[model samples]
Every structure is written in C-alpha cells, then in structure tokens.
Target: MNINDLFLCPICRNIPLSERESFLNGLNYHLKTYKKGAFIARQEDPVEALYLLLSGSVKTEMISDAGTVLNIEIIKAPKPLAPAFLFAENNRFPVDVIALEACEVVFLPKKSVMLQLSSNEAFLRGYMAFNSNRTNFLSERIKLLSIKTIKGKLAQYILSRARGNYFTFEINQTQLAEYFGIARPSLARSLSEMLEDKIITFKKNEGEILNMNALKELVVS
Candidate 1:
C-alpha cells in the first residue's frame, strides 16, 4: 500500500494534506506483507511500532492455560492494531494477531507515532477516540465474561447484537464459543434450550428473538 493512503485510515481521517505531509516528513516506516494464517505478531511481543493494517483482516486471539483458544476480535484492514497499547507502560501485545487472508501492514516507529500525536491535533483526537471505543468494547467483554451461565452469556450476546427482533452472526458458533470462553457443546446446548423454550429461533447465521422478555430475563437472571 502506498504511504499516501495511510492518511485515509481512521486515525488520520480527514487530515489536511499539509498536516498529512507534515506527519510523514522524516518518518521512518516499513510495510510488510503476510500470507493467510501467518502470525502478524505474537502474544507478549513488544509493541515497538504502530501496526496499521493496510489490507485484509486478522484475528486477535489468546490461548488459555487449558489449551483453549479465546477469540478476542476480528480486525479488518485500514485500522491500527491496538492503538492504545502503543504507548502503554508494558507495551506488549496481549494477544496473537494472525492474518485471516493476505494482508499488508505498515509499521510506524514509536517516535514517528509520537510525533504525529503531538504535531497533529486531528491525529491525536482520532487516536484517543479509537482507544476510547476499544475500552468500551473491553467493558462489554468483561460483562459477558462475568455472566456465569452459558445461557446467560448467550442471552447477553444476543441482546447486545440483535437489531429489533432480528439478527445475524458474523462468526459461527465455534467462534462464538471461543469468544464467550465456553465449551462448544455448552454453547450448543444453550442455543438448543433457548430454541426449545421459544425464547429465540436460530438457524444458520440468522436468528430471531421469539420472546424478547424471556431473553431479557435470561440476561439478568
């Protein structure tokens, strides 16, 4: 990807050409490509640079002590990976990032990133907003993890993602189980139970909430 296109990314969105040129001046950056299933970065690796995904998608995941894989998030192209962690004290990746398809990434050194943050108000604000959104997402993840029962977790998941009475899943049940940190069978059973109880109707990736009140009760119960 051309360095000029980096300005199109959310962190640099709407930045004036003058400011963009100013941000790029003397900046040492590298672009690297990865094949599908390649590990872009390993867990606990030092975040020496800001990783900007220029193309393709990747999954952020962590393996549990019991050897279970937890799916953290799927990030698409044109976004920075863990923007908030770039300047963190520990400054290490919390999860492994693996490419879901052929991907191109630009690595901007910490110094360059800091320069952009200090020199461009727009870039700084965009960076802060991106991190704030990630914080909110983590808070919701924590809420889901706190729900002890599989049914309850599934209920909360459905409630959060549903649009009116209808919804569609981006990931399959296996991936959903990983996200919920539960056994696949457990999640499957809960879905079956919900269907049998007329609380929801799920088929393939699409679903409908048959009993919205029941789902609400399940979430709080």
Candidate 2:
C-alpha cells in the first residue's frame, strides 16, 4: 500500500500535500493487520489511538444483554474508526469492530492526532465535518430503530433516498437485513407485501413509488 495514500483518507482529505507530508514526517504510528472474523477492538476498549483503515472492511456491532447482536454499520477502507469517540468523556469503543474481511489499519496515538488537530487547519476542519456527519448518521439510525415495524423501517429508508418517485438501493436485501437487525426472509416478506399493496414497484436495484402517501403514512404510523 502506498504510504502517501494514507494522507487521502477521510480525516486527512483536503489537507495540503506539503502540510500532510510535514505532519507525517517522523510521525509515530503503527500498522496492523487483521484476518477475516477477527475482532479488531471489542466494546469498551480504550480509545487510545486514531484508527485509520488502510484496506478491507469491518462491521461495528453491539451485543445486547440477551446475546443479540445489533449491527450498527459497515465501514470500508479509507475511513477513520469511531472518530467521534476519540475524545469523548467515555473514550472507549462503544461497539465491537470486527473484520469483515482481511484488513490493515494505521494507528496513530491520540497525542499525535491532537497535535495534528492543533497544527493543521485543514485537518481540523475535516475532522469536525466528519464528526458532524457521523452525528447525523447516528440520529437517523436511532429513528430507524424507533420504528415499530419492518415495513415502517423500509418505508422510512426508501422515502429518505427516493428522488421524486424513483429511487435506487445501494445495498442488497441480505446486507440491508443485517443492517436493520432483521432476517432476510422477513425483509423479503415485507417487501413483497409492499409490492402487493401497490405502495412501490421494483426493478433490479431500483424502485418507483406508486403510492407516496401510503409510504409516508407507514413511516408516520
């Protein structure tokens, strides 16, 4: 992997090349690899470093007291891991980050990250923007979890992404089921019901809203 590419990750984007190189010069960092199914960091682990994924993907999941696993999100390479938690009062991993596949990551001690935040204006701006977006994402997740039915969750999701009466799905049903904490069959059944009710019409990877009012009602109800 190109070392310079590390400077292009989400938290480092828009930073001037010279300044990025300067900050990286003599920087203390560690590179680590994880195999598929490996737990990179378990819940409650200290947030001692800024983890920048260099390759592959991972899923952030939380296990409930009843041993149920709630999949929070899937993060691919070229992104920071739980950046918003880095400086929180409870500076610890809130979810278990497990490798979805073989992966490599760069670990920069929080002290070094703080130094970068202080010295690099662009870096600071990028960091803040990333965290702000993360906050919004979490808020949406909470809203999704609050909905009582799978149909309601599906309606909210589709309506959020729909452009006018048309929309495209980014992930397949299987992945989406995991993200929604439901079984594949259940999601498929809900979707079939929606189609049968004429609330939506579907094609491969895309759909058209046949009854916008119905979708909105499902979400609100």
Local accuracy of candidate 1 as per-residue lDDT tens digits, 7-106: 7788878678777676777468899999999999998899999999999999999887797987788999899998888889999998999999999999
TM-score of 1: 0.81
Model 2 bad stretches (over 4 Å): 66-70
Please, what is the whole-model Cα lDDT of each candidate in the order they appear?
0.88, 0.89
Model 2 lDDT tens row, 1-221 = 66676776887878887786787864588889999999999999999998999899999999888989877888998999998889999999999999999998898899998888898888899999999998997798788889989999999999989999999999999988876778999999999999999999987879999999999999878
TM-score against native, each model = 0.81, 0.90
Who wins the TM-score comparison?
2
The Cα error of candidate 2 at residue 81, in Å, is 1.1
Deviation of model 2 at 26, angstroms: 6.4
